[model samples]
Target: MAMGRAHVSTDRPVAGRFRPVEITHRETNRVRWYADDLRTGRPFLVTRIGLPPDAGDAVRRAPSRVLRTAGIVSRLCPERTATVVETAVEGGFLWIVTAWIDGTPLDDVLAGEGAFDPVRAARTGLDLLDVLDAAHAGGLTHGELSPGEVFLRPGGPLVVAGYGLTGTTPAPRLTAPSYAAPEQARGEPAGPAADLWALGAILYALCEGRAPFRDRGRFEATLRGVDRLPLRAPVRAGPLTPVVQGLLCKEARERPTGAAVREALARVVREDTGVAPTAGPDTRPRGGHSPALLCAGREVSRRAVVLGAVPAAAGVAALVLAATRGLSGTATGTSSGPPPASASGPTGSGPPDSGRDEPEPGGRGAAPAPTGPPGSAGLPPGYRTLHAPEGFSVALPAGWQRLDTSGVSGLAYRVTFGADDDPRRLAVTYSERVGTDAVAVWRDDVEPLLRRSGGYRRIGGIRATTYRGREAADMEWFTAADGTRVRTFGRGFLLGGGRGFSLRWTTPADGWAEPGSREALRTFLRTFRP
Candidate 1:
């Protein structure tokens, strides 16, 4: 049963049709090859996996079992899972043929790029959890999930392979023993929890640059290590440390459910604004097809592919929770206490709103010129630096004191500043999770919600701009609060690593053009530092 290492003959086509042309990737007991369909002259990825000698009737039914499982999973996950073209069993080996994936394997990406930053890894983990969530919900399990089975497209959702081969043999796991869950290592039935464990292992590998359990030379030995070894603490997982630890819990019952994992991963994705788009070597086969740029009617953003199916409420909650927690690490707060987070404050005091509003003073909402050097320096008359305990500092008018503090504790926070009864106010918001598109955050996410608030009128189109060399956007609007018309100018900027800040300056709509009011907007933007 080719147990030691999988071997394939290059002499002839497998099933008398598919011919292996090049070795693509290899795991403990599996090998992936770039192959050609002799009859169709089309390129494909064919995977060969070893089977136990005593597999008995399972070997006879392997082809059908693989096909059935693959079909079930493909329907559950759609483009997120690989498309299985055919399955076959010959010479004590099971062969799986799938359409050529137009991307690099996850392992190959790690090899080429070394250990990924925690933010990028969390983004990938979120994508993987999406497929797992769908499969588990449909009562299916991905028996063998490892970096080798995951394919990452440049600007699209990742595609996973090796769906149906897990139960085709009596052996607990067919390949990548290091990724096997403890139950699988003990020769017990694997369930959705097992897939979650593997998902954690993959996340660990992506951040640490190695599998949680090292693969011993022999498959049996590797499984033994997985079953008995103590896990090495993940030093680089950062905020994802808890998630990796929760999923790797020895008892399957103790591991977090797929939904819980999704929530945590999504939170991480939202909080880390520094994650650049995932990049890797060009692994697309010669004459191979390019990956589809459009996913579910929207063009994929270069940062990450957000699942369209995720509940809107859940997304809003993530933002709210983040803002409620505020930017503890990267945020500045009053000395009395740190700022808490949320989404309900006036413009620039919380999240910026997008869409049409009254025409701006400049006719296009252009920001006025700076009045002083950045920080507390060269202040015009009575301005002073308000140093916040949360780690950011900004210049504020003499009468301005922290008006409100709201946040969720860690996700994000917003602090408003104003005189007790004054019509002018300044709001500073720090968020750990923010979209790369500053314009979209305002127009798409923030604006829709603003429209529902009382008498909200936008000034102009959300304008894309740069602040201190970082990607940023600006929006202005008017809103009636307690029968008073207030004009607010908001500017939000990204600081990478899923972290960002927004400054909102508000005053009586009729008094927005006063020299003092104009200076406050410029001073806040120039002096603020997270």
Candidate 2:
């Protein structure tokens, strides 16, 4: 189980972002339990219980909109060391929790800490583009970055934790699968340059802690050398390593905005606070107050950290400073808000198609996308689109071909409708951040290189039909040198960490010994959410 943990004397839920408690009722209308979240000790899921006395003033305006989305995610990285809270559990459930962060997430600390330190991992990739330039300029889009949502917490009481922002809103549920991208991991609609290609695979895992491409064994053909690789200056002290090789360019409009990635991480926090050498760009001293003002409204700290700028409507009073504590985007560059052009690109694409044309830095047309809003992209979200992450719910499987494309409003494609000769062996996938359960991935670095190919193995199966708000597990696995052992399944839903996630799948059941592999792994984990 490699480094795979789960027993420092168990507290439970601490596997991947530390899982804790999440005991939702029999779809008894979600909620009824969301008791704790003081930085992920875990609990919060009042996914809107029974409605009427007329939706009780919309569940009293949802714990103040999940504490104003954790006070606008702590004023967008006010020096990253999280803490967002909002709980109203048991029956009329509702929750919003944060703070179980502590270093090691540049995709699992660059797999083994190789090439980064480059100015402190280029100022932690410009403090994740200054909190994704205040959550896509107040629209939010951490679609699901990786390295388990890039954390790094070095020194005692330090910071840098973004653990998947409760599945971001307006419509989001494509958790970071190996820093996602290839058209949002073949599902789609992941903006903010797919969080700049998971921040250039965390600057290729800071020069090599563990990223260069995935699915191993030939590693997806080395991503054509990461879509035509070419980067140099790599030694360490990660202060924006030449702007994280220019925001790890694989095209998303050549990369840089979110206030130029927080002004290239405030010039590497003014050379890690020695604060002297000045002639070209920033040396500090713009006095309102400085001496590394520890965390308060956040000015800088975390080995010279200093990202500030959060007001895309900062709510829940930014969680009273985390007891307290804390923590952008664009193609290569362009900030000052207003750009995601309403989730740009796909439906009836091209004849004037546009994701606002950004790419060019690394050329080769770098992943052109956006396929919605214009002609309604591929349609869905029409009926005034409200789905919000309140509690959460989803379930797909019926004949399986529901696409509704164009800039996907929160996710769910459902294919396996493949025919033209029984070719669709068994592909039952599901997507739903129905409210945010926070997915932490890098899938154990692509499951040990996809189990070194000779036919993978990450199994578990038999038994099913257990439903309600949901919390399930079942399996039947295979990858058989080529047999692709059919009926497989995996489930661990709790989608309320922020919005929803913990989804799982696998289907190719010709064998795997008997009982249609337990009703096709219980119809792929019972069609999922409700």
Q: How displaced is residue 1 in candidate 2, in Å? A: 38
Per-model TM values vs. the true structure: 0.54, 0.23
- Candidate 2 structure quality by residue, lDDT tens digits, 1-530: 01111222213222123222322222111122222222412222222222222234545564555566556655644545355433332233333344333123343233322454455555455545545544554455665455544444322222433333333222122222345555543434767777766776666565555554543223223333444445444444344456666666656777765446555655665666656312121212342332123123222343343111111100000001000000000100000000011111112111111122331111111111110111211111221111214222232223333222111243532222222332223222233323221112212212333345445454321211111222221222344424444322332332223322222223343432233322222222222232
lDDT tens readout by residue for model 1, 190-293: 89889999999999998899999999888888898999999999999998999999999988999987657766776676676544333221212331322221
lDDT per model vs. reference: 0.64, 0.33
TM-score of 2: 0.23
- The best candidate by TM-score is 1
List CA RMSD, all candidates: 20.1, 24.0
Return the number of clashes found in candidate 2.
92
